[model samples]
Target: MLSRNVYPQTRPGKWSVLLLLAVFSLLIVFALIVQSGQPFNLDTLFDNGWAAVVSILAIAAAFGAFIVGLYTIFRNHERSAAVFFTVSIGGLVALFVLMQLFL
Candidate 1:
């Protein structure tokens, strides 16, 4: 079996690994939704003006989560997982930006 050195092989690894996975998945999903904001009708976006504000804040939160996740992974000495999170988060961030700028 290909061992995933992505997470620590310690007693705390099980729960921490699951938590990290959840964070990464949430970020990816949020990024995809933001990238494909087509489903979010801009026309109705301001229907509750604050809804749009909340959505913007949600994007900021995802960015915050990405940074926090990176710090957490490295602090746990999960070097491989740190690299994986970096690439995953960075790529999605880039995709989100491109989609916003070009589409």
Candidate 2:
């Protein structure tokens, strides 16, 4: 017998899922752009290891945001948490696009 709480909670609202999917799709596009070999040098911090540093920092920031968002959601602040997560992810997607565009 599965308790009510044992099952995963119902998925978020349709708009929420749609918004997330859109953001994720944009991320994929940005990744493809980066992988397409467009010549643009945006890394000025580390001439030799800029790529590695950028990748690490980006991943760390995303992980941190996800942890905070998950905490907020589990603390009964789903609305705010969703907003935070969405905004964070959206910002990352925009950054990726800009990087690919200019760099």
Candidate 3:
């Protein structure tokens, strides 16, 4: 039997699992973009491979931020959680822009 508090609590390894899932998703999107052969360029970065790399990094960073947010939330660190969430969203948007420009 699980207590209500336990049910509401975040699992210790959940962040890592979520990060891995996000990585996999990003990889799939990268592969798809590579297959499409579309022209993408923004601010000097032009190669398809490099674009993919930047996108993957951005996604990973965003995922890391989200993980931090989760940790903050679980620990009742409201301010830090808000900051992490904002950064995570910003990273995601940056990734999208990079994809449009370079991939």
- Candidate with top TM-score is 1
Q: Compared with the true structure, what per-residue lDDT tens digits does model 2 show for residues 1-103?
A: 8323322232432234345555455456546656666566746535435444544455444444444444445554455435455546745755775697799
TM-score, per-candidate, Cα-based: 0.40, 0.35, 0.36
- Candidate 2 residue runs with Cα over 4 Å from true position: 1-48, 81-103
By TM-score: ranked, best first? 1, 3, 2
| Residue pair clashes in candidate 1 | none
lDDT (10s digit) by residue, model 1, range 1-103: 8556664454334444444455556556556655664555566655545555655554554455455555545675554554455436644764796799899
lDDT (CA) for every model shown?
A: 0.54, 0.49, 0.54
Is 2 or 3 the stronger prediction by TM-score?
A: 3
Native-to-model Cα distance after best TM-score fit, residue 37 in candidate 3, in Å: 15
lDDT of 2: 0.49
Off by over 4 Å in 1: 1-47, 79-94, 98-103
* Pairs of residues clashing in candidate 3: 41-101
- Give me the displacement of residue 60 in model 2, in angstroms: 0.7
Range of the 10 consecutive residues with the lowest summed lDDT in candidate 3: 3-12
Worst 10 residues of 1 by lDDT: 10-19
- Candidate 3, overall lDDT? 0.54
